[model samples]
Target: MNSRLPATPETLAEQAADWIVRLSADDPGERQQAEAGYRAWKQADPRHAAAAAHLESLLGRLDDIRSRGTQGPARQAIHSARPRRPPPRLATALALAAALLLPGWIALQSAPADILFADLQTGSGEWIARTLADGSQLSLNSNSAVDLEFDAKTRTVDLLRGEILVDVARDSSRPFVVSTAHGNIRALGTRFLVSRQDDATVLSMIESRVEVRIDGQEQAVVVEAGQSLRFGPGSENSLAAIDGEMLETAWQQHQLVVRDRPLAAVLDQLARHRPGLIRYDRSAIAKLHVSAVLPLNDTDRSLQLLANNFPELRIRTLTPYLVIVDHEKNR
Candidate 1:
């Protein structure tokens, strides 16, 4: 395949798809680096203008995918799979895009004033932990998200999505806190991994004690070492005591650890650590149970292992963005 960007509405989609595959390459430069290639192509031939224009149009829609309201799959799909190239008169297109998508592009001209407790993420096969100037440690578990907020009052972070293992730094004057969409966790000098589940946020405390407040509940539970708790969504409060570090917080090492969990949950966890989405018929394996410690960086190997154990499972990697398990291989 030439992997050239397409100009027409129908073929533009195909070009976008190709850009995603190349940008998602393990290399870090990605979009910025890919620009040089496209520019070179543009100089190579006049026809490249259409491809470049298509790509620029795609890039202009960047924030639509991240907007608070009215953002959905289409926006997310495009942003997550953003292409890298110099579209036709891209600078002008980008300016026009800013005007169209925002109240005023000038308002967002400057980066946000402050960034507190940032959770910098790396792609597949890259694992790195960072200790912020503030007394806190953030370990990004490949393809993770850590939302940060810091002010004179307190240093706080929200794991809006994905997984993070944190080692709490000591500072009595200010308590370190991490909150998710489902609940808020107040750490009292503790280390733990917090994962956002479909219906609850799972918190596994590795050291010291941590208090978790669910929704609007006044009563909070203290998770001790070797204990885990789940706070339900849209509910007052919920709690549980689970093994400390056994099958939990295991992604710290870039591995997916599952022990007899529902297959659906296990697959969801895998999808988070890797790039592509995993899809299976809800009816076929809804109740299936899974157990194993698999590597998060390699989707193909992970699927191969799954297919090996469950010969009845039919697994296919449709593209860089989608994986589909249609039916049992044996069937």
Candidate 2:
């Protein structure tokens, strides 16, 4: 039996390192506020304080290495120095903190700035279902984040990343709206889905109707039940009829149903349920088509299934968090 827990960024040690990184900000006001919050967080629990202490010690050792000049004696001394290895926990924390020090590394390793601090977020391969204060049912897909802003006039869900399904409760006075970077979707009926894609927003009408308005566009389009719409800046708007049963199976049973979809598109959806990076050559597998029902919760099994279905495809694990998929011919 493997007793070791996976070293995820959501651990206590990583939270302490996150605070340390926040405190390193150049803004004086931000640093001051962060310091206050850090103090409270450290004092709130003994584990937090211990984690912080471990991270600080790790940083101190790194600072010592940096202090040694890169030329002559310093470089030689650095090569000769044999520092004691930190415990497994401290080593993992240090690795995560070191990545954060690099520019844009946090965004690459975790999520965007807005999504990182979202009110509700799900990590890779994780899903969550919640009932809002207004009794509306909300379900978030893997690697998703959303912020809620409810007021007297409107009940808004700001989707920062990934996809969300909402079963809106009827409120005659207040309208239910789902907002993405590309546009806003107003729920005209009840159940619907809104997804924030790489360069577009997709709306999947499950039960009722939705009014979609793209950014900078005055005219709004109405999407009926069993229909899907894709809109963005450069891309032309596309509306297509969808099977309600397949859509329902996705959210209800955590299954992804596809029919003759491009391998790239299917991989993109699968990547959301997977942690780390999934690297593949776009041109290599451009002609490959996929038609299957994949299990969202078990991404490892799903990858195996893909590998089994496509004998010409090669899937290799470069690391625990990094995967490489390529056509056999590419090699």
Model 1, 179-237: lDDT tens digits are: 88777899757888888766888787777889887776787777788777777865434
How do all models score by TM-score? 0.60, 0.68
The number of the candidate with the highest lDDT is 2
**Candidate 2 structure quality by residue, lDDT tens digits, 221-261:** 99988998889888688788988657887778888887888
Worst 10 residues of 1 by lDDT: 98-107
For each candidate, C-alpha RMSD in Å? 12.4, 13.3
Any runs in candidate 1 off by more than 4 Å, and if so which? 1-126, 234-249, 319-321, 329-331
User: Candidate 1's error at 306, in angstroms?
Assistant: 1.9
Q: The CA-based lDDT of model 1 is what? A: 0.60
> By TM-score, how accurate is candidate 2?
0.68
